[model samples]
Target: MEAKLWFILLCSVVALLLYVIGFWRRKAGEAAFAAARAAATAEDRDRYCRLAVMAGHREACKMFCLARSDFFEDHRPLEPFKSHGIKVVFYGYYYPSRYTDLLNEEQRAFCRSLYQFKEGENHGIGFFKACMSALKLDDAPYHIMFMPCSDEFKYARRFKRLDWYIRTHRKGRTSGLYDVDVFEPRDSLHEAKGGENRILERNYRITGDIKGKQVIIVDDVLTSGQSMADYKEEIERCGGKVVAAIFYGKTVSVPPMLLVKAVVWGGYIKTG
Candidate 1:
């Protein structure tokens, strides 16, 4: 009986040791991840602030001062505004709510004055409102353009979190190749498909009275930039000047020249 008891005790001790080792390793891993994330956040914050400064946005200095902590968490990097004398607008996909209450009246006025665009309904304009509110900014004259990219459907499927469709369709000839072909011909096809005002239900809503203004086009990513080109043409036709364009991510291939200026991070990092 004593021998059996000794064996049981030994097994129990080994199990406890194993559990302790696993727990320690898990904690260490979590700590390492946290450290890396913090470092990345700091890097992104510095890059954003530097870009804003380079763009000659005096308001950026104050905006960063008020919202640096939150900005760090958001992981958005800033791009230098190309136009020297004109107002440098910081366009983004969505605004975060946390910044609303933090902004002073003057800061709020500035945000309000800036032209802003949200991509789509699902892209989360509410978050922008939250950020505005947190910054204590009142409503500005912002235009919300809801242009859903034609490839958005395919891109959504390609990069979906749980890709059951991809798995199921693996055996069959994939739609992936078709998407590639479409993208290749996207420029000419998109141009023929009504060009600028094709997607606009009421182009007058956003296009009216934009004449001679140095409009900065903003989007989440810049792959082929065909969509941007279309938008730029439309804007120009409506008497708006396409001074610059900014995207969260950039591609290496040919970019649309109409933008005159552009900025992007090479790879993926959450901007909105």
Candidate 2:
């Protein structure tokens, strides 16, 4: 039909436009990165940072926004959650390449100061509290669980304690309104396979029973949604209804070459 043909043509044109814009943005980003590297001085680097944004380098813009603690507040997690029977939310984005990995000592110090991690700070609890308040679940009793991370990640260990803190500290004085428990998996996927499917095998076995329980999954980041998808499938299998999921950040893909060069350049600039 003529309508089908028109639809296809429209989609093709839109795809082509997106491709052209992406190519232009990447080229501009590269030029800006090169200029920033050559500039060496703080004032010169700052000037190049503005140029990168003006040139439409999204990554550069992310870095500038991150440094100022203003990450464009336009991330959407709802679309990814539509397929699965779950709701997910994220507070902010963790940059693909941290400034410390791409800048000199002075720059690194400045960047560190911008995003400082104080001792005894648990971002998960903070986000959880905010989520509870926003959802107006002050009087509702619920259970919390964690999507297991690699053993090497500090977040994994921190959650073990944070889980306890939430159950004990976040509880209400009223008996029915404050009951909380944190679930853990005996095993978890350590890594993801490469290529199209990016298939991940479920290595987790829930340590506790959650028959007819309302559960929420807390994670540090949501990458491909594969891990969480697997988590939801397994949790539902155990009769636990997943109401929502919360994450500290969402993962954004970055060019592998840029990441490698950032580390190399950071080391070289530091020594010089």
Candidate 3:
């Protein structure tokens, strides 16, 4: 009986030791992650603010201030506007939300470890760096216009976010100016299926005048060209031309013809 009791006690002690080790490791890992995230957030703020100061963009300075303070608090997933702006200047494409999914496990792990967004945010500082590293800012266009996002939220907050990022970062070197008021989506047909029928119902009307302006349409995803095409037609009707369309992801679940005219993350890949 004493021998059996000793064996049981030994087993219990081993199990307890294992549990303590695991608990310690978990806490250590969490602490490391938190520290890394804090560092990244600080770095992003400095980089963005420095760029804004160099460019002499008034609106960007305002955004930098907002980002620093806790005044504006929305938890929804935010898009990486810096990458979108930078990509538009060079390759006309930005990193997609799922772009990391395509990378090898090690590369993906590195990305996840390095970049972290605040609660309810999607991509983080790492995504912005990836996009910014693609090209030099001097090559960006003088006159850049942002297209409205989908019609779901009624306020077009995402579209406004993108517009804010571009206006602040691009810094318009030439005398030519940047305009954010052009297109506004009157309906939310993005989630609907089928082709031009849904696009017809989308009703993305021109709220502000785009007459005689060369527009650059930016969106999170480009599935069918219908919405963009519609925007182009309306802009043209008002004597404005659709100079280029920029998107983070071009979904490949659609027909092949649609991808031909669009520019998305890495250009050609199945996003479905």
Candidate 4:
């Protein structure tokens, strides 16, 4: 009992410390960013700008974008897996190996920015264009939808930018597509962990119509699959059919399949 109490106290202290640090960092970041804008010397300005970015300032972070062509590799298929009785497609594996760890991290960061920022829309469109070319969704009555985020602004930005790319890019890919907007957020809620249980026990309300449409959920990563399962159940409960789930990658310690595929494609990751 004494040890447990001590552990609890330690955890609380750590959490409080982290919270305080985060608050300080945000303030520092904003100030540094302002200083960078006002600095007369280029060196001092660059230094302050870097500090702001490192401190996680929103505007400062925007000035920097992660894009390295070498990070591009074969992304998709994953042998047509299933999640909660719905077909799933994993475009790539978000793994960092010994040989190409930095590249992998940069690649993951760039990929994540797809849904997080508007600039990523172009990349996201091309990324999906390649995936769409690879997929024979001719027979599937698919409607694009993203993994529902309670943050309405983020969700709205994400789907709006990426969803219509296929439709506008070419005539063939626009056969029977719709922006599946059956659901709307009630209020903001923290996205807690626990995957399925977290989703099942959430406080925010999601109201939707469904209309018996076949949904294709787009997400950044595919992890333990429970979250998708919960999403699948939620979609079903709301009266829509989950035809497929598309992802940028699956998280893994070592991406054996990705390496194998890369080699078979007549090339490997060029570390140069």
Candidate 5:
């Protein structure tokens, strides 16, 4: 009986030691993650933010989403505006480089992150996906299409997120992903970036049957209203009705003070 008691006591002691080790290890890990998240520079935060986001840390994930009311709050949805004639809904206005400097440090960092996301940064896909949620689109059997790309979208990560958002937004109930065969242009139309809009022709052949479908057009930025106009015409020409067009930002040429006034008018700043 004493031998059996000794064996049980040994097993219990071993288990207790393991539990204590595991507990302190977990606490140490959490402390390390917190330190990384609170790093002074965005560059440092970015290095660890990826690991936190992948680990599903809620606070760390907040950096990659604009769902915060104090930041990129939802605007009045589905309001028609501008000359394009499509219902334009955007998260916020994108300012020029000089104007961007006026924002506070955190806000400026976010703006930089957004541009980085646009330039095909992989870890920034969450921001793009969060932008898509601003449209308040209902699961009413609507189709999704991205604007035509001459080759694979220069921002291919953002393109794939567009597809992923719609499909999972309502749990497997949306599709009509905008894909097109890359039409070799006559020459490198560098001006496709803007300054000369519709004069340069794009030979994008949209695929699949979008006939009689209500399509939602997705794009990075809406500027000059020309690319969107062309896409709208193409979808209509193919018998698809564009119900709404959503963008990450609309180019606004406001002076710095006016932009600051607009944000102040929003009453979205956090004070604690």
Candidate 6:
């Protein structure tokens, strides 16, 4: 009886060991499969999956198309301005990498034809010109507003540089200059000792009358749309109707609430 009991115990131990090993192998295989599936999904979503890293512009257009399609499925597609009798405007920044050097000789010339500012001009001048061109309102009588979301002090330094440059180079042209506006949502909340979870308040100050006017909010990149959302809220609060929001580049993830009217991509190739 004692020998039989010992034999039974040994067999039980062997069985338990085998079961544990098999269980571990199965778990590992499942985990590996899950990881592979996740990777494949991510690759499918990424426009630059098979393309080289430097070919960002080429991939950016594809990503924009995908995002546009996704956006249209959930929300109404942007109607043509001609039908609505709405004024079309374009706003953008002068990214040298995007227009000047990114293209071949012919393409570079073509972009230059549309470019108002000269090559290697101050960034602020380029930005102002680009905004005017984008809006299609170069000759139209309208107020210009500058709403920089950056820190006041940091932007103050840039403004000072621009101020000195403008005063020295283009005298008398700085009179009707940007109605300066600042949006410091993050920093303001941080200073108040607000927790990270606290929703930041949208603060805005408008120099001109925005009531019953169609406004076009312009930005460089369309990311989480949080900044745009804040801007839209403030603009509406100040009685300005946002006709459209234009962006130079559109990222993969954009918030649904912030509707993007138009996006221009593939205008730049990352040489670096």
**What's the lDDT for all of these models?**
0.38, 0.55, 0.41, 0.55, 0.57, 0.41
Model 3 clashing residue pairs (backbone): none
Runs in model 6 lying further than 4 Å from the true structure: 1-124, 127-131, 134-138, 157-200, 207-216, 241-249, 252-272
From the highest lDDT down, the ranking of the candidates is 5, 2, 4, 3, 6, 1
**Alpha carbon lDDT at 182, candidate 1:** 20
Output the worst ten-in-a-row residue range by lDDT, candidate 4: 62-71
Q: What tens digits encode model 6's per-residue C-alpha lDDT throughout 33-70?
A: 33432343444433232131122233333333333445
Question: How far off is model 2, as Cα RMSD?
Answer: 13.9
For candidate 3, the per-residue lDDT at 224 reads 47
Off by over 4 Å in 4: 1-78, 96-123, 166-208, 254-272
TM-score rank, highest first? 5, 2, 4, 3, 6, 1
* Per-model TM against the reference: 0.26, 0.54, 0.39, 0.48, 0.54, 0.36
Give the Cα-based TM-score of candidate 4 against the true structure: 0.48
- 112-176 per-residue lDDT for model 1 (tens digits): 43312122223323332233233332333322222233454533432232123323432321212
Candidate maximizing lDDT: 5
Root-mean-square deviation of Cα positions for candidate 6 versus the true structure, in angstroms: 13.5
* TM-score quality measure for candidate 2: 0.54
- Estimate the lDDT of model 2: 0.55
Instruction: Tell me how candidate 1 scores on lDDT.
Output: 0.38
Candidate 5 per-residue lDDT, tens place, 126-206, comes to 544454455566666777787654455553555665566557754634555545554564332322444435463666777
* lDDT score at residue 32, model 3, on the 0-100 scale: 42
Q: Could you report the Cα RMSD, in angstroms, for every candidate shown?
A: 20.4, 13.9, 16.9, 14.6, 19.8, 13.5
Please identify model 3 stretches exceeding 4 Å from their true place. 1-143, 150-155, 173-188, 195-197, 254-272
Tens-place lDDT per residue, model 2, 1-272, is 99999999999999999999989877887798678656767667655665665556655654444433322333543222332556777655444334444444554543232233211244345555655554433455567877654332443454655566676786641111122222333233322333214566444466576778777776665666677778787778888777777765565444343443354345446766
Q: Tell me how many clashing residue pairs each candidate has.
A: 17, 0, 0, 1, 0, 5
**lDDT for each residue of candidate 3 in 1-272, tens digit (9 for 90 to 100):** 99999999999999999899877755554444334324445555434443433233333333333333222222112222333122232211222234443223433453343222211133322333333344333445434444444443432434444344555654542111233332445544444544326636433445555566555555444544566666666667866765555554333321132221132212223442
